[model samples]
Target: MIDVEVAVAAHATIGESPTWSASERALYWIDIKKPALHQYIPESEALRTWPLTSDVGAFAFCEDDSAIVALRHGIYHLDLSSGELDLLAPPPFDPRLFRFNEGICDRTGRFWVGVMFDPVAPAPAHQKGHLHSFTFQGGLRCEDDIAELHNGMAISEDGKQFFLSHSREGIIYRFDFDSALGGLGGRKDFAQIPTGIGLPDGAAIDREGCYWCALHGAGRLRRYTPDGNVDREIKLPVSKPTMCAFGGEDLDEMYVTSAAEGIDIAEEPLAGALLRFRPGVKGIARSCNTGAVAKMARVAKRRID
Candidate 1:
């Protein structure tokens, strides 16, 4: 087992994830239940947060430096400089009963977002959950019908394979991806979380192609080979670790986020905080979104009309 240590204590409730921003050399994440966006710069020991009107599930930065966020109400573009929120367009179907969850950008720069029923509520029939791809021109296209809860997402270094998680089912699926068509096929089970550990949430792939996953209720982060063999476990100080990513100049440091909401009183200190550790594993190179945001904008305009 690899020893994991806490780097920072954010004390955020429902801390969702950490995304490496190569351009800024910083880490970005969110506090879903708290409805805030956070950015942490390791070198400068700088941490900043912006409050949002709605829960922010996930987001990716556009080439123009604005952030596109998946929120409970709909999608919107957030200008980090001016703190402006520009509503794009709502999801194609009714989102009143569902909300966005885990999401990331594809190699082509399109933002791929997933939606799931709020855990506090009973599952809705019309809401089977879905994976949607958003381009600046296309708005939001339902890409695939997913399980009731879709979480962690990772793309292979070659961009030929896509990994998605069914958090509640504790299973991860691998699909062959076609970059040209923005489609997926040949779905196969990739990994299954060992019973009793915890359900899987967000994940990141290292340069070795090994997947490192955050175990939501387990208070641990685990690494597994591509074939699903458990390799290492990094225990966390928080009981509700939500997601992780490799950041810092060398990409050798792992930054994790946790949630303070819904935990037993004993685990309260671990809730709603950001944590980090150095695992000495180099991460895969960060990929950029080519023109996906532009395409999504066009799609949003058409959908609005």
Candidate 2:
């Protein structure tokens, strides 16, 4: 495996955006601290970015080339072609205490997201974060609520397992998943971040079933087997590697995002930025957006019979 390279310089404060768009053949990410949405086309080396009206935590592509974004306040529909934003749903639970963190679409097109206590909000005496799964037919359904500091999330290729990480606790959990029933069962420990290493952040799985994760504070990206064994490690030049995904025509290129959250302004100038590398492993195909449009069609067809 090759070492990682800085694709984008440290132009933002905290970068947490990471999503793969198959149709556009591009990787879309957000600079959460900078509060912007960015798209990168690796083949042409073309980069496009747009300023957002609020702090966007994560986003997924819609069928019509638009996007569904999870902001600090709620979920919104964003027109990728024009950059227009429209509200979709309010926050699932207590709006004042929580904000959207990490999210991904499962194979069945359900959007799964995590909510945590807002860093800017006052710390409650006993606050616990939550994980939620949103289907097109049903609204937001609670999956789990055990994380202290919710972070990275991923699902298995067969849609039978789900992985979730708690950055603060430095542990990853695996769950038995049932997509049709919209429920998670039999949670167990998956991985644990050793102290002084980096906290686990965003993650992706390759076609071979290895889990690749960004080590948020340790300046490294690691690949692990399903049993939680470390398979490989790639050190980064920048600290705070936030997230990563595999893309490119052949799905060999690994894209990463970094953050500048806790670094001194002078120590590492380019703290929050985008990075890329070739790790020689193929990634699984990304799931399609099952937003309102696709979900409605399925319902209408079923009703006609």
Overlapping backbone residue pairs in candidate 2 total: 1
- lDDT per residue for candidate 1 within 1-305, as digits (tens), equals 55565556777777775888887888888888788788888778798887887878888877775688888888887777777777786765455667888888887777888887774455446446778887776667888757767887988899888888988788988899866678888889888987887999999999999999999889888898988888988888788898988888888988888887767746376566678788878887545453644445545655676
For each candidate, give its TM-score against the true structure. 0.91, 0.90
Error of 1 at 39 (Å): 0.9
Model 2: per-residue lDDT, tens digit, 201-300?
Answer: 9998888888888898788888999888999988887888888888788888888888777788588876776788888878886675765563453353
Q: What is the lDDT of residue 90 in candidate 2?
A: 68
Clashing pairs in 2: 17-30
